[model samples]
Target: MNNRLFLKEVDQRISQADLHKVDNAVFVLHDQLNMQVWPEWVREEKPPLVFIEAKAKGDSLPYHKKKITYVLSSMRHFAVECQQEGYPVYYYSTDQHYDDGLSDILESHPDLVLTFMTPSEWDSRERLREVKSSFGDRVKEIPNQFFFADPDAWKDNIEPGYRMEYFYRDMRKKTGYLMNGDEPEGGEWNYDEDNRESLPKGYDVPEITGVEPDDITNEVIQMVEEYHPNNFGVLDDFRYAVTREQALQLLDEFIEERLADFGPYEDAMATDEPTLFHTNLSIYLNNGLLLPWEICERAIQAYENDKAPINSVEGLVRQILGWREFVRIYYEAMMPEVRDTNFLDFDGALPELFWSGNTKMHCLQQSLKPVIEQGYSHHIQRLMVLSNFSNLTKTDPRELNKWFWLAYVDAYEWVVLPNVLGMSTFADGGILASKPYVSSGNYINKMSNYCTSCEYSVTKKTGEGACPFNYLYWNFVDEQREAFEVSGRNSFMVNMYDKKSDEDKKAIKESTNQFLNQLDRYSG
Candidate 1:
């Protein structure tokens, strides 16, 4: 009877265009099935219901209560969607407090209890596993079908040395998404080099349409206003695709409108550009509502229909087959301890302004501005900007993991964990990535306009006018030198540090502390 999860997802971030389409879609499903009430989809009389939440751990700013509101709202929405389409949904908030909900669910006496596989935090899956052992067949946890890859896919491939390039190449061969028989469509497995073009000066993005809410969404807005009055993210631009029908429209928009430029710029960043050449589709992709096969089919159909170029089609498919699939598989292949792997052994808490966007660092401010306005950021902003800063500053993996999960509109643990802890922070020891994506102000400067407007100096390594990222980056490297040595990619860094004077190194340490102590200043 509690179907709020599904409904809230629809209510938040659903475009006005898609709202009409979703309404029509729900009507079609209603007419086609000649039925209503989601629980009816439990054709087996009992479906071993699953309760889901894409939430942050909330060890830092904005606190955990705000997270509960977002996930609880979304889960409630999903529940409503299921009830409308004929399925049983039993959900709890995606928070530190799922135990009581789990206990309540246990009392429901389901044939099985289920949860999505996660690589970010161990407690979620571990708790579910314990629940399963006690309940046996009555608690079967399944890999979330939201992702495109099989859960075991990453585990299945073990070459002489495990690497993403090899896996990506293999995927290209198997799926033929951008393949010309045995040849890759772009003559390469990746177009990352071609994708790094920065947003040109004064280049304006077109005025885009936003998703408006339906009755269910309006109800969620009411709930947001009443039940959880202090959620951190903005509620104004809430337009997430929560239902199967609406999710399709999002898929279609990406295919017809943005897919053409998606591949080359998937990694690029722009200060004024949020969507840019990228599709803000991860929200739909992470949720169970959006099926990967259908998305792939649409991209493939676009190419076959001659509507989009091969570069475009290949780029779209690569994310599904390469990055997205790889993340899920990579997450399952290594976990439990992976969540605990803090390469830098970073123990500091997350900053206060991550929630408030009150920082002086221009990159942090602008990157966060959109997050405040729309509750989203492209992958690079998540990985390079936010995650990169956390890594450089040596923020605790646990804290960063929570921030990644809670702060973004698109974040769900299954997708965010490996990307945050493993890939972004190197907290998982290279199971998800071969090396930590640690970088300094220089890299951000090259890719974004954030550094251009910031108070910090991108070129300075320490002291006055120094970019916080610069000092923090060096400090993190020096502290974690032993750990990075194990990665085998730290030779250049080691050499660089070895050549530096002890005085310079001492200065770097002081500068990092200076930043950390004044976290409130930078955070705001």
Candidate 2:
């Protein structure tokens, strides 16, 4: 929070070619098949252009120092692709020049600078608004054709006070994914009962496709190494889907090997298992390299061709059309005000192990290692493990929020912020999630085998071998007694808290604070 240090950090990022790629595909949105006249928005604005490339406040953690370079690198590559096809392109980097990016766009005086709409940090949306408004008729925010939902689709009716189940069901009917006319294929809207099945004890994951980017990414990797030298993951291990070809190849791999079991073990976790049945597709999907529709279409093609099952295909589709789209829409409908809403009102520091990965708890240690080693963890790991722990500890939403934003590779503020503050932390009332995803170590045991060799007992709440999570869970309940007392969803927790002896209650408080006293060091 030191202003001098903060400004100094900002100054550093500004010099690093931050705006290396900023220009967008300047296009006239035309209806090719209809052969009709272009819309007034298109007509009024001569040839419209948007600044497509983005940059973050890389003044934070260096988990993916390569992340910044990847963006600039891929953008520069994308710019080349556009230019080859005779599309005028402009690009910028926040590293080399910061606000100059906006100024450069203004000098062009393009009809409308379009971008896939997103919110950065606290001031980003407002700053973008000022830039757009300052330009008067120039800045037009558009829906990312990258995602499944219509841009304004969820704006008018953001289904509040509901979890994803109902949303998933509605999306099934609307999209006709896994549907035959009006009825769902397999006579099921969701395969929840079937999907939760785990891989047999020593399950082996098939080979995954890794894309070593072309020279552009290689150059960016070199740049990140030269500048932001010290980071969590090894740069040599960096193999993100940087270009369109790599993304498509990865899509084919998962569809061929992992897609069938992906649905069943989507939420499963394990100590030794890194890429169990999960398709490491998020990195590609988050970046513009792979579009969600193409992914879904390919998976759906597999099902129709009898290569993959309806269950597998439908589950993957629901993620894109249902969960992914829902999150983006819900995020747009309820941001700014929503980010600050901490309904439970719990306040405490996060545990030290989050950054250090120094914990005796085996589950955390195993899960957290990948986050450090790769700058990526799937949604289940983010939500149910690291984030769930943060919520239960009642860590300051901002504190936990900052870590999530700083660490992950795919964590652009637009995507990460909503997932972090809204879904993971549940700071925004119940807008993104119905309840705080608080859990004891036992839940971790149920999901993964990380509990098997842990020093602490998942089965015990107190005594010499008592799990720290047991203590934390009880303390979290007691800490938020006033708010949670009325929560019917948390009634069972309250009842359990009431059943605890004073000695055990005192012990839980002591252990929980000991854990909370050291928050900054822990990422999980």
Candidate 3:
């Protein structure tokens, strides 16, 4: 009853003969659209492909308009590509839940057997399992192959007190990437120390290419607007690649133009440029349009060909082969409870500035600009600026995590939850990160030119017209003095805060309290 649109259907009512004639159907989830991951039987037998656009799933969050558009458009494109390759395609646009939508298909074709790869999301996997219960052996679930990390291997090999660096080393050894026999190629496992240079003035970043919306993407844009009018983010310049071919082209461009300088400027922020020398492949990587191992290989190839340096190549590899894989493993290990764990117990609300981008603070405004328009910004902005400010303000980690899930195009429960709760918010208390990733105006000033044009004085540490980050950071350190001392890793922060003069300490409290009160007035 909730079948909203059947965009591409070979037959409205599949015959029993049609169902029995094929070996089985492959129920391709939105994120599992890549051909490389398909079972060998699928390529030989050319099984019917099933795709469902479940409205209930989209409605679960106030997702950014562009995020929904990207997923739906990419799914639609993949379904058509499968059809061109002689696979029978059944694409359903429905207002029902994924399981419920599949139920209709099951009822229509009683002889149909559905094969699905295990979903990246925990909830989606569970829902598919529920469908399996009703139909018994009709639904077969296979392991996901889009990622380099194996979940079963992670459980067996990963020791307690899990750390990404160790896991990353093991992965490098296993893959033999950036390795000189048994040792690392550069005699070092990490080059993150060299990756913090800020962008010099008037630096010209290479222009990123965007795919023009074809008829398929244009139709998807209209459909998203019709259904999700209230969603966040603008769709004015919709430019994401909807097909694997387009994604590959973008990857090639990054390797040629950006990968060489990517390491030094990876943490840099420019007022005029949102993405500087960084590969925006996560958009494709998250949704199966791109594979993880292939992306790393391409970057390594650049290094081998002398097109890129080891710092840049290893840095990029660490992101995909190291951090990304580790986070997915962490998410799987600490789910259902990690979503709500507030280790710091800070319950302040996320400010309206995040939604409106109406703050006079230039860093917040500039950092939020790309996110508001494109549902994206680089990792540095997401961590050092957005998350730093949230931690300083004492915003509930859960609220900030939810906002991130709503805002980013590359977000999903598996990745977003761990990064937000574990890494960004420190909500899980040293589970995924050793310490809280908090910084003051000084770090921002060093990394970006946002401070140069900010309304507040970045130098002034207290009183009116002073940057709020300066006082809020000190106040957080003073307030959490006991916690830092207990942790022992960042106790120097407390020692430094203790050395401040009594008058200076008093002024910091006054400034922070005054700003928080004014913030509450407007927020309420």
Candidate 4:
């Protein structure tokens, strides 16, 4: 088949009104809610269907190449599936902004009414709003049904400064997951204590299975390479599942092979192993390839069959049902203003080492290697190594957030904002977390094997050859003493800092300042 000619024919048919028998059309965005050609409401109506996969504007932020390929290829494959089902599918690919592409579509059919599912991201939602305003009643937005929980219902239950624990419990009761009638399984709401063990030395890590790139994915990889050469991550070995079947297979593999051990080592990291018994299912989950409810149900089944521990199953379920849903609600509740939040008033620039992964710190280096290569590193690596260092050095939370948006395959504004600004950096002033996640090298050393190979000594608190996290953590504590003292959960850390001798505090402050001052010159 001549691909160029096929695309040209589709483009020509887009503007010909006589070819489309239906007046109304549903526009399917790149993220497929399911394998369906159209929503049930529109299927019987037999309206025309338009599936758009446009390359949006704003080349300023270079997305990870794998991300570009994943979204586009998945979208293209969905369009093909729709076409095979005998729907009038219009697949639009372009370099212009999404709005521009939509305008072109509007020009083709002047009287056409377009319907869409409410978008997930704030910016895209805003764009859709503008389009709606322009078209008036002709544009319709249906409630996004892709999510496991209802956002409005979740928001209604939330009080000011509501904690995720409460929301999690409510979800547990509602879903009847890990529950024995009115009581939680094992008479507990959480099994986090049992899930914090580090990976023992010489443990055999299971090989991860990944979907191979087919012709469609290969074409997308080539397009990203040629059009966005300077994108953040390398595009080689692109293995993310783009179709619903492939995604389900990947989820089954995780449940069977990795879920049993995921809980204990969920927070652990290693020098060479990036996944470390963790479910790398966030990419699939965020992209709508797998529903949160189904994933959680499968985990519960694993526990029922005695294939995995209760701790592991509950831990995995909590992330999707509790943390994931909570973050989405939080992001929606605190947007526009949340983007500019700087609770600690941190203003440091993101270091060059974050981009180059050339830092002397082995933890940061090892963590960043996977991010630059595969657009992934587990949550522990994100929290302990990347965000911890940034918080200690006072790197601007907004800058770090933007970097995360560009670097990770799973990142979306709804997910990235709360995790980075609220949870990771404490830039939201205790909105998502009671205490800052800031920690010294001790935490890293306790959790992973990274400290064993570091050039800097994890034990040294200050001066040359000392871990930068040591002094930087102390300096951050001293600098934010007033805030920490007032924080209910973090007051103990302030009291700890106050007990340190005056001489020790002074040395810590000096080392911190010296290291921060020369940070620009210390890049790899």
Candidate 5:
């Protein structure tokens, strides 16, 4: 937002004659690393590629170190690859913002017209538009090629309050993925009911074979260590794929080794098992190393070959074709307003346990530890454990959203905003989720191994030594009974809460207040 471009130096290789010789150049963001998503002119012209490593963006939050390392490393590697492929690259290691970097590029190259594909996130697109406004017709923006459906496509088809299932079915019909003529492949739009089984004891969990860091990544890791010495999480075993080929290999590995069981144990969690049959390709997919249609097609192919069940393939497809696209569109539709919406008016600060992982609660410990260590966790751990606990304790949705954005490897504002404020916390007033995803220890006990070795007893419903979730969930429901009753689908939760005896209700309130006050003492 500041005019800090004057502080940074332009690459010496980009001379005025070179700029005049170039008719057009393409601006590449950190996320748009793949050539497949480039403008059509890019391939023919083989024009200069401009990349900016904006340190200001990295400094916006105390981001996980591995996340910073992965993004910068990938961008550096892609720039190197582009140079090797006979393209001139102006790589700027700037301490300024993206707009400053773009302004410098335009000012340095007066004769050179710039072409850029639309960035995935809203803020990035807006920044680019601001730069374009300054440059007039010298800049051109193209459609984004990474996603299966354009965000604009939803303008006529859907709105904020629409359920994802309906939109997912529409996507299925539009893409003809998992569709058998007019009906769904299994005569159902979703296979979620078949995809909730817990992992069996001693199940053979496949080892994740991650991509070892190359010299480029190692350099970026050192750079991160030097610049972000005090950032969240360590970069000890950095194994994220930095290239399109490596990302494809990870996709293949997921389909071959894990896709079959992905449906059965998709929701399951275990101690020290962070991935657990889930495809850890979100890092690549969120960037442009992998495309959505290709990922969905591969899953569908696996199902058609009888290598995976329909439930597994359909579930995977639903994630990309259904949930991912839906959330992105929903974020676009509700943004700048959705970011601050707190329908429940939750005002508690995020617990210190989220950052320190200093908790006796087994589920929180197991879930938060991996995130603190690796900047990664499966969706259930995110939805059921992290967000569920935060919602029950009345943590401010914005604080939880910021923590997620700062912590996760795959997080960006566009995706994290809707999932946290809308689905996870119900901060959007049941627009994105029909009901809040709050739950007691029962769900965690059923879906994960965390409860087995927990300090708190899952068997006990309420009182001392009982699971905090049990009492906290009822307390939330009791406190928000009017809202629950107003939401037609979850009014039964209020009815269930009313059935408890007066003595039990008092115990529940007491235990929740005690736990919350203790949390506030330490964190708030």
Candidate 6:
């Protein structure tokens, strides 16, 4: 046979083998949960399984190409591992709706009983419910084992008001992490106050030895490049841990090297150093290569072994057990409505600089550059730099949320909704955050080195060279003063703004208006 005909024959033989292997058992795997961390019940069955990595339709938003490659490559790697472990794997890569891909698989195997872990996102869960309705007794859904906290329990225990601190304290007690028999080990639930110090001058930032993409990942990169040419991020330098072994290795590296100072500089930003002391394990954790409990316990063990400090260990644990879990629960509790919220009613368009990183604003350019290149940015850069600019510029919360959903490798609806719409934009009306996370250029100047070489002057509050954030922040406060005055959490901000002189306020408003009017000029 010719080369093309020989390849076709090989493909046909593989398809025949896959078909013969199909049995009465089926497990549907989503892209996010791309690991073999299934429960005991799932392990009891040694049967053919299905994993779908569908290029979802109707998403006009430009997703980061690196994000797509990471998920697809990780899923493909996990499917290969499953096949090697004696499970017949039917991995589908289709540019169609997820439902269509799943339906085709189910239709092909009439005798197969479907089993799936409940999805993390509401929309996916609802779609699965519809599938379950069709399959009836043949379909079964197990509770997702990826989370340390139970969603139902979270919903039940939550009181009239939602507070992450209370939930975090409860989680600490439940898990015995940093706990000393009914009390926290450090005598406090949070070490966040000590965790906010900026990176000291001349301190050497540890270099992260990220996993090099293997043959499977290289193929995935080529696939994404050909299929998703217009995607938001660059595809080169796609270094992510696509397997459980590699994920664990990355985690070990973080615990041994970076965790020592991760606490003190967790919120700090630098001009060229994106990761700094931050753990880049979120991509692995979110994708299910690493479990949250395992990561949290490992960090705690690092503290016990004196490899890392209490503040560092506690901070890391709190993020996984506290904020991560809290945001997930919050997403589930308030979704369908949370997705539509716009408490401040700001309906501005997202700037093109968010995609191109071509703006003169140094902090934004610095933050967006990494995101555009790597589909990765530390949490501080996301919140303080990127999301803060979006909020202050009056960008629509929904648009910002979509942008985040498309941009970050770690982005998922469950995490991004609460972080962007609730915490960043205050769009959920204090559901997730007490106040808006808007800040002037002073915070950026204090936390980062970006301002030192910026085109805009951090000191100038108005006119040509003034930092956009300085005036835009005041403008946001002015526009939303009535809403801020009503809430005890934000009333102080309004009072502070009210204390500003009329001249300063007018200059701020004028500068903000001028900048807002000329946003298109700066954008791509």
Model number with the top TM-score: 3
Candidate number that wins on TM-score, 2 or 3:
3
Any runs in candidate 3 off by more than 4 Å, and if so which? 2-23, 156-160, 520-524
Q: Per-residue lDDT tens digits of candidate 6, residues 176-248?
A: 8898999998688888888989888899987888778877777777767777898888988877788888989
Question: What are the per-residue Cα lDDT tens digits for candidate 4 across 217-333?
Answer: 777777788878987889988988888788898888889899999998888888799998888888888867788889999999999999999999999999999999998888877
Residue-level lDDT tens digits of model 5 in 193-215: 99999988989988878788876
Q: Who wins the lDDT comparison? A: 3
Candidate 6: residue pairs that collide: none
Clashes of 1: 46
Record all residue pairs in model 4 with backbone atoms less than 3 Å apart, i.e. clashing.
none
Regions of model 6 farther than 4 Å from truth: 1-23, 31-36, 57-61, 156-160, 521-524
Off by over 4 Å in 4: 1-19, 33-38, 43-46, 58-60, 156-160, 521-524
By TM-score, the better pick of 1 and 4 is 4
Q: TM-score of every model?
A: 0.77, 0.82, 0.96, 0.94, 0.95, 0.94
lDDT of 3 by residue, 1-524 (tens): 55545343323222113554664788889888798888788888888888888999999998999999899889878877887778777777677789998888887788888998999998998899999998999889888888898877785443335789989999999999999999998899999999999999988799899889987777778878888898888888999998999999999999999999999999999896889998988989999898998999999999999999999999999999999999898887776777789989998889878887888899999989999999999999999999999988989989899889889998988888888888887888776777788888999999999999999999999998999999999999998765466468799998999999999999999999998887741143
- Relative to the true structure, candidate 6 reaches a TM of 0.94
lDDT accuracy of residue 427 in candidate 5: 90
Q: Give the 10-residue window scoring lowest on summed lDDT in candidate 6.
A: 1-10
